[model samples]
Target chain A: MSKLTIVANIKAKADKVDLVKAELLKLIEVTRAETGCISYDLHQDNANPAHFMFYENWQSRELWQIHMNNQHLADYVAATEGAVVEFTLNEMTIID
Target chain B: MSKLTIVANIKAKADKVDLVKAELLKLIEVTRAETGCISYDLHQDNANPAHFMFYENWQSRELWQIHMNNQHLADYVAATEGAVVEFTLNEMTIID
Candidate 1:
């Protein structure tokens, strides 16, 4: 199976930056321990405090999908509801 | 000097996907040889062939800025002119 690369960009409401950031940080530890997880790194934009991105790699798309449906991710979604102003997700594969 | 992570997204004009992708691919080898480059990986969207992204890590923003001004990058810009439809760049820091 081919590796999966996920680039998920999230922007928080101006006033809810910290709340959204905290919720995003909460996902890191648990998600990193999941099966097939290769790398799960979170980044915050230097110019836009409200912008956050997750640059993740998984062994395969199947494993990534399982990770996506995990309870913790659901909790993250529920916790950050309405606080996220924009969200975009891309499932990609390395060109090489 | 803190490390920098760059997420650059490029979208090709509908009819110019191949041209833009080839131009982008021409960048990898030269860029990876530059100073302070840690990783310079490229990805293509699984659902959107016209979308390409470069996920890069650098030792410092200063080094990355130097890379940004290099001749090879200028060449890439020249080569891909009018072939690219959309581009977005984010300079980010890991939330460790």
Candidate 2:
């Protein structure tokens, strides 16, 4: 049980990008229904209306740290404070 | 000329990971060299052993179409056949 990949590079506020893309599509469908989620995808940057990407997969890393302490992604990160100017997170494996 | 984003998910055989990785390093460099390319990042799932992604952005679609025709990438595709188990590509736009 060691499958976990989470790559997120979110930057918003190019005129609020349609209210942060409708709150990131309900936060990627509630993080793909948690519980060792296998996939959760979200993307943007058709010219960078404030670049964004959140492609995730899990089955380990302690269930992705309990899906980042659930609670609706901590209330959608406190309702997207400041609309997230910039963020980055990357953890990957599988060298082939 | 608007912005464009390209995300590619490439998979490789669980065993042949090393060899292809080296070849890919060069491929990515060349693609990134394209005149309009803004970003091109590659990633793989930690547990899947046969899952990957390629995140890319360009200034416009015309240049990206040309990039697809680049000879080097054509060659890499030929070099790794069975090793790739699954692949996917996504196109996105900022909706906010």
Candidate 3:
């Protein structure tokens, strides 16, 4: 399977930062358990408390696609309906 | 030193892909040798041949600032000239 490295950039609403963070953290455990998930790490911007990102590794695009449509992901999106202001997904491949 | 994770998203001009790749790769060795560099991983997009990104871990924002002024980085920027289209820098912190 070809590897896929991703940087998911997220910005939580100013007033809902903590709630959004709690909801985002739940995705980590559930995402790591999915097939082809090699690494799923979450990060926040030190200077910007409301900004967040996820550095992820997947065995293949196929597996990642499935995980994207997983129920947990849907639940997360639903839970954070107005909690996020900006959400961007960046899919990458190692240069080595 | 406080940790700082960064995702540098880059896009190379269509004609300068190989040259840009070469220049970008040179940063790996040099950046890793810097005082606070813990990890400096380069990656490209699977679907976008011209797109690239760097996943970096620095010991502190101060060290990273010094790195920004490093000669190698300056040289790379100069060497590439107009080879880049869009460059976005994202600073992050581990959520753990």
Query: Over the stretch B1-96, how does candidate 3's per-residue lDDT look in tens digits?
Result: 779888888899999989999999998998899999999999988778899899998999999999999999999999999999999897888885
**Candidate 1 C-alpha error for residue B74, in Å:** 1.1
Candidate 3 CAPRI assessment class = medium
Tens digit of per-residue lDDT, candidate 2, span A1-96? 777678777787778767766777787767777789887767785555667787676888799888888887787777777888888776675332
Error of 1 at B42 (Å): 0.6
Model 1 fnat value: 0.76
Q: Any runs in candidate 1 off by more than 4 Å, and if so which?
A: none
Full-model lDDT for every candidate: 0.95, 0.73, 0.90
Question: CA lDDT of A3 in candidate 1?
Answer: 95
Q: Give the per-residue lDDT of model 3 (tens digit) for A2-91.
A: 788887889999999998999989998889999999999999887789998899999998999999999999999999999999998878
Model 2 complex DockQ against the native: 0.21
Model 2 agreement with the true structure over B1-96: per-residue lDDT tens digits: 877667676777778776567657667878888889987777665555456667677898889889989898888888876767776665665332
Candidate with maximal TM-score? 1
Best by lDDT: 1
lDDT of 1 by residue, B6-38 (tens): 999999999999999998999999999999999
lDDT of 1: 0.95
Local distance difference test, candidate 2:
0.73
